[model samples]
Target: MGETGKQVVLTYEGVKKLEEELEYLKTVKRKEITQKIKTALSFGDLSENSEYDEAKNDQAFVEGRIALLENMLKSAKVIDEDDITTDKVNVGCTVKVKDVEFDDDIEYTIVGSAEADPGKLKISNESPVGRGLMGKKVGDEVEISVPDGIIKYVILEIKK
Candidate 1:
């Protein structure tokens, strides 16, 4: 059966990244993992070969990740950045904000759940910043409470 879930709306960039990952997994990564398994099998002793065991574990993880990506792709609904018309926050918007308390400027790209990367400042729609930023227009100030503190930000720009 197909993916049984609501379709996730991913930004154009997010979808592109997913596509790239899928390509790499199906091509380069798959081959590399298969070779690893094969080489480990040559060591013999399926029950005692540490290399074989490690390779099997790695294979399992890789296969699981592949399945997950395939499912997401199956259920993905790619959102066209150009079609989202608004000065407000959106999944594809790169928001630049000035901290209310610390007086620091931070930039983030709002994306779907699969694309969250806090270190890179790409937040998921389910995140505090992403949720707070959504539907807020430029110049609109919003408060988001993080594990650090409740930080405030002004919506700078929303782009396609």
Candidate 2:
């Protein structure tokens, strides 16, 4: 959590993934970076050593990522799978929608920002389409505004 006190919403799987990444960064990555730093130090001349500079930069990035992961975990609110319902569009719901213009059907899993992966069809609840579909029923029609333009979609199904 940051000073804003905003909670980081995550599903059980998302939490597990983050935890695993955090563990890897703290254990394996930290040790590897430390070794690199040591090896670079052995080469002498700190000011002009490119290896040392690169190693230090990598160390800083790793430390920063560790801090970010820790903060996110501290503020994480895991959504229970059992609590998800098919009644309406909501986080953790997989929605099937028909694109009005192209007449194509697409399935999307609504997830939190931290778990949103467009390539995997996992959309954030705050996204344009996700927001437009939120609280909508199976037969509901929605118009979502994207960077390109407005897109119309009809909700066909909602499942947990």
Model 2, 85-133: lDDT tens digits are 9989999999999999999999999998888999999998888988998
Which pairs of residues clash in candidate 1, taking residues 3 or more apart in a chain or in different chains?
none
TM-score of 1: 0.86
Clashes of 2: 0
In order, candidate lDDTs are 0.80, 0.91
Model 2 Cα shift for residue 96 (angstroms):
0.5
Span of ten consecutive residues with least summed lDDT in model 2: 1-10
lDDT of 1 by residue, 62-142 (tens): 788788888888788777867676667777778777777788888888878887889999888788878988888889989
lDDT score for candidate 1 against the true structure? 0.80
